[model samples]
Target: MDPAIEAIRTFNRFFTRHVGAIDARFLDTEANLPEARLLFEIARQEPVQANLLQAALGLDRGYLSRMIARFEDRGWIMRDRFEADARTRPIRMTEAGREAFDKIDQRQRAAVAHDLNRLDAVAQDDLVQALTKARLLLDPDAPAEFIIRSARIGEVSQVAARQSILYAASHGWGRELETLEAETTAAFLRRFKPGREECWVADLSGTMAGAVFLTDEGDSLARLRLLHVEPFARRRGIGGALVDECVRFARDRQYDRIILWTHTVLDAARRIYAHHGFECIATEVHHEFGEPVQGETWQLRLTA
Candidate 1:
């Protein structure tokens, strides 16, 4: 299995348990998780159309219908007909529904606050940042933007360290990967060329979102190395943008072609490269990252 898949699953398990998602009734309320979430969404989008509500929350039409019926039976909600759209009635909470929702909302907030209060101030802030990043990464369709800039002082090491840390934690990759990243980073910095070679770091509002290095191999050849996007920043086109920057620079420098080596497990990076016109030219299976991995070489020939 891909390490990314495992990492996501692990996080999902931990987070669901942490938030009491497994409880029969959420926060000891009368509703389950799905019911509570739909109730909250309905309240948030007051006077929402039933169709629009189902689409927004992605609840099954049948399930939504039943839940609405249940709520109506409890006198917690009602539908109002308006002349604006005669096709369907708009759904809204009754006075009792609002009261119930408010009580549950207060209890949920208090529960979260109580848990947060157990941690120090710094830990609480860290948790918030982590959650925000995770949410962004998981939402592929969400709007996002990142800036590409030259690697700064100390950032070369920072990029390499992050690569090591991420791979080690996600894939059970050992220190060999760490040593290799450190060595390559050192080489890039030691033989740095102002224009002939470059390293670009993706910046997301002062955060290190990703990094890629373009190296000038002798004889008009270029090598793209160490391309990665932080997990929270993936699916946001940062990887493709980095590859584009490389191609642009290689063309500017008169390189004949660009080559990159990456594992088959990196499906996202591979797709980004392929979308940018890079083709897989060769592959070999090896046990470099504590498992049998198919290492692939991708190439893109520059056109004059």
Candidate 2:
């Protein structure tokens, strides 16, 4: 009767019916999971660093090397040393690989759509709504495989600088810089409960591309704070993963709510928060750095 076991069974059933067919038709024909994953990564047309892929997929170095080798042999992807750094190698899909991946993607989408179409319009909407809510609710209490490890203390300053610059530039914080006291910023971090606060730096290969933080505000509330992804890490789902970790941590701790702060200028962070069912509950114009700025508060309720 355990919920975890029940969820596992539910997923196993779903995967058995949906995943088996897709895997057999697409992945089985081309290669194993690793190869197919690499193919998809290359097909994205982004110069993916090998170490990034390794961390994202959580594969052993030897296994990833073997997977890349197979793709190289098949000419599905081309590996090139990073232009800025010869030591780092990034990969991209070849023209032929793109064409192949398109077919595979189309087939998978169609296969998934076919089943969804079986549900009536209202039922489909209901299903989607239910799933979205379930995900947020389940996420807060989920066990985390990744731990909040250490980060360079300097990165905190770097992240804050980038965030403030970007925030000010986009949001017209002309004099706001004067209001943002370094002491206040330091205090915010300093307030974190030592035993409960956690920070994780996501190292994409050798690059520290993103960071996330979780802070316990009270017994029933936790604040997911200071999630930042470098410009280079944008669109890679790094931000989403970081937020998800915070949500999971809160859930595991039985927190009733998870809260975060942002200004209107941070659209990407707002979107991620919205996607995870966080809603803006309060807004105010505050003076910061000698400039007036609008700040927003958002909260995701973990309990119904």
Candidate 3:
């Protein structure tokens, strides 16, 4: 099996076991995990159509009908036919069912708290971030909340380290690239100007997803440097967001032109630049990052 698939399967097994999801009773409740989940969903989205519930949970029609029948037998829920559509029935929880759901919710919250309290604040945050990213990956259609903000203290080092590791892993670049990134970041910080130079970090739902830098190069010229996005966070318009932020900042600072140096192999970044009206103005061959590679300079003219 593929490593990714195996890893996911392993995590599923561990999580199911950890949560007692395979047990006959969930959180010591009378209902099993699936039944408890169904009850909670009904309580949360009451008056929701049975078809909608089935679609949302991806449950089989027959299986869902049986679960609904069980809930009805327990006097926890009622299915009422829609006035306009006899075939469509909405599910609602009874008073007893609502009470049961509340109890289950309390118990689940307690269980989660018990587990999370074992970890420190940082570990809890890491767990939450990991889960959020995993959920986003599983649901590509979900909206991603991205923020382009000023780089926080110590974040410049983070940017350099991330860029170095990612380039090394993906493109087989060597320590030369790492050294260059570190030096550039350090130099920018040493000579940083509040209004003229800026570094922006792209944050996606509490995770540092990407970063970019803009520096004054004199004579109305601004240089864009060290543009990078995390590999897993690509294709989500993060690269574009970073570039857009750079251009906006440059224009606000009254720079006439913005320039950047990048290699030819960075097709995605190049595409984002081109989309924002940047033109390639220079090219050369450089063996700075281990292997021979074509280097290109892209420039964009800022309009007043």
Q: Return the TM-score for each candidate structure.
A: 0.56, 0.46, 0.86
Write one digit per residue (lDDT tens) for candidate 2, span 1-304.
6998998788878876666544544533576445666677666646888788777778898888887787778877786853765226678888877776776777667877987889997678557645544553455333222323446666556556655665566665543552452443465567856656666676553345567777777768888777877554456677888888778777877889988888786788899999999999999888664566678999999999
Prediction 3 TM-score vs. true: 0.86
Residue 208 of candidate 1: its Cα lDDT?
72
- Per-residue lDDT, model 2, residue 78, is 80
State the local distance difference test value for candidate 2: 0.69
Give a tens-digit lDDT track for model 3, residues 176-217.
999999899999999998899999998888878899999999
Backbone N/Cα/C clashes per model: 0, 10, 0
* Candidates sorted on TM-score, descending: 3, 1, 2
Show model 3 residue runs off by greater than 4 Å: 1-10, 83-87, 137-143
Q: Tens digits of per-residue lDDT for model 1 on 116-159?
A: 99999768866875665766766745566679999878888988
The 10-residue segment with the lowest total lDDT in model 1: 81-90
Q: Which residue pairs overlap in candidate 1's backbone?
A: none
Give me the overall lDDT of model 3.
Answer: 0.88
Q: How much lDDT does each candidate structure score?
A: 0.85, 0.69, 0.88
